[model samples]
Target: MQKIISASNFADIMGVSKATLQKWETNGAFVPSIDPAGRKFFYVEKLLGVPEISDMVQSSWEEEMQVNPLRSYTSIELFAGAGGLALGLEKAGFSHILLNEIDHDACVTLQYNRPEWRVVEQDVRTISFKQFNGKVDFLSGGFPCQAFSYAGKQGGFNDTRGTLFFELARAVKEIQPKVFMGENVKGLAAHDGGRTLETIRNTIAELGYTLIEPRVLKAIFYQVPQKRERLILVAIRNDIADKVQFKWPDPYHRIMTLRDAFFKGELYDTDVPPSEGQTYPLKKQKVMELVPMGGYWRDLPLDVQKEYMGGSFELEGGKTGMARRLSLDEPSLTLTCAPAQKQTERCHPTETRPLTVREYARIQTFPDEWKFAGTLSSQYKQIGNAVPVNLAYAVGRSLIRLFNDIESL
Candidate 1:
């Protein structure tokens, strides 16, 4: 993976001017990430798959235009991983009737945390949601996004049949919640030239719901101290759509930093409590030691940089995460399931080690009291894959407001 090389560095490598590359992006080179100040970053490998779209600019504000929703709302969460979404929604007033997850450890985590809630540890495909049909108010889950089979004409619902999303759609059709939401990586919005999402849209419509255009929500804007982004899709049943207005949650009072997450002051009542974390091997540990807080491989001495990054050093892209250390002032880069991976290193800001279980949870806004089950790696995966608790809480408030309007009408 190329770290985030600058546009100038990339343009030079590609034998093109910066203007020409920007033009390519305008003409559909690939979607890029823009910082708060509008600095853009491109993933060199990902740029190869960028499909041209005349509508590129407009997509940025789509999430901002929509409305967002809900207390006393009965909900079922499918593919629930470690309760990030469920916990937040519960805090906002929705009661969970059932939560289903296939991972045993994740199920344990959920069950251990909330013994009163019904947590079903089973593959979603094997369970029939027909029992809850018309009884649930909200259906929420983060379905794993898989590539659609382009082997035939883009199949809509039927074509989605073997994937996890198919299971999600099946539940939606069976349970028929007043409103349903799904979350996935932001990349899903552009995956496979958008055909996957197109299929999803068609499937939602076929089930008699109005598809709210999905928008990518940046976690940083919602009080999370990590730069994770999730594409959130919400749909309302056609029959009730007109009766309620959905309002997206407003941004948090301020952007949170790793300092807020790791130390006591604002985000937490206390500093990140000491917990188990993974350690780098001696060689990798020594290499990471040279990386200053907030600095990455680029800040390393030239020879050390090359040795540390291996072949990645020769690449134009910075692969910025390599030999990287978090910053106290800025939000941490998006976390990965394993913090110590060479390609996605998330070295602690002042430590030469990977983020600890508690630090990882804090970054994702998980409360100190919440406990994770399973092996250390499994715990990391669950946290890394979650919708940030605070972000979900914000969205949950919007849901409650929407339901308030719906019931009034």
Candidate 2:
């Protein structure tokens, strides 16, 4: 049976504005049927003609999940926060030789969950990966994006010395794994007028690797119930690069929504477990109560909006994130380190309180049994900074396929 989605839901899935859909309808590029209530709806099957949309819905997520590593493959992970990516990659069949993180709480979380993992709690700069040279099959890290001082100068590896990316590149240079991936925020692609990425490309070239064109992977398309995106860069050692081709992971057949997260659905077997969460102050609570589900600051009364937004009220552009109440029917907005902050309020849909720690984890696709460590704030930070687990698993499966191809050759 063909699934039917409202125009707004369709816009959310395709990552386009409602106006664009309207234009497409007028031009006959894409048309929606108007119902008796004057609501426009689109059949999911009809979207197959759109190239980007087809790429996501055409693949079978069930088939992809069946992929398993042909043999034991070893990997090393850097900036391993809360083990979201690590756990997902492990599920995809890669065994970790070392998982490194500098944060005390994050290291504790990793160690607590995976006692067998070699969780190294130290600065990545102080570690030596030379010992793993030519031994490891894969290396990956989500290095925090920082503006390269030597970007556009073509200084290659040595020029990136002080940045966190330098640590990842250093690990790559030292380990020389068959395949390596670097993850970062989606904005990194356009950072400093794209010079930052160009420098990274050159650095990979100097290290004797062939850099594949980087892509921004959306979490929602990979069975994650949040609108998060990560930029991924995968490179293969030049010697093996020509012999094998790396294919990007196919997207899941459907976009997951927040309903799938908190409720007992495809995402979880049980309802969200009770856990500690932040609460709004009395004054803020009153204002938030006025916000309808799926509504933001604009939904508030004029007087309340004036009082709450204060200076931001007068600013240009829609401050959609301000006083935002998440909708149960749609995926959540990209999470921030602090959910209750004035600029990025992540209020519960039915209640006036902020999302709990476990609820936050659910949106990021962390398994319910995966407990976090440290203070409540620390747990939020760890989860917020993580690459969504399902997204990582999809990417990991593709990497495993790349390795399988390399093994056959």
lDDT (10s digit) by residue, model 1, range 286-386: 88898888788889899998787777777786577778898776677888888888788899998789999999999999999999999999999999888
Root-mean-square deviation of candidate 1: 8.3
Give me the runs in candidate 1 sitting further than 4 Å from their true place: 1-71, 150-154
Candidate 2 lDDT score relative to the true structure? 0.90
The positional error of residue 198 in candidate 1, measured at the CA in angstroms, is 0.6
Best by TM-score: 2
lDDT digits (tens) for residues 1-409 of candidate 2:
1277777767877788767888878999878988898978888788877665677666766777888888999999999999999998998999998999999999999999999999999999999999999999999999998878784457578778899999999999999999999999999999989888988998999999999999998888889989998999999999999999988888776778888899997889999999999989998998999999989999988988888888988989888899999988788999999889988999999999999999999999999889999999999999999889999999999998899899888
Kindly report which residue stretches of model 2 are placed more than 4 angstroms away from their true locations once superposed: 19-29, 34-40
Q: Rate the local accuracy (lDDT) of all candidates.
A: 0.81, 0.90
Q: How big is the RMSD of model 2?
A: 1.7
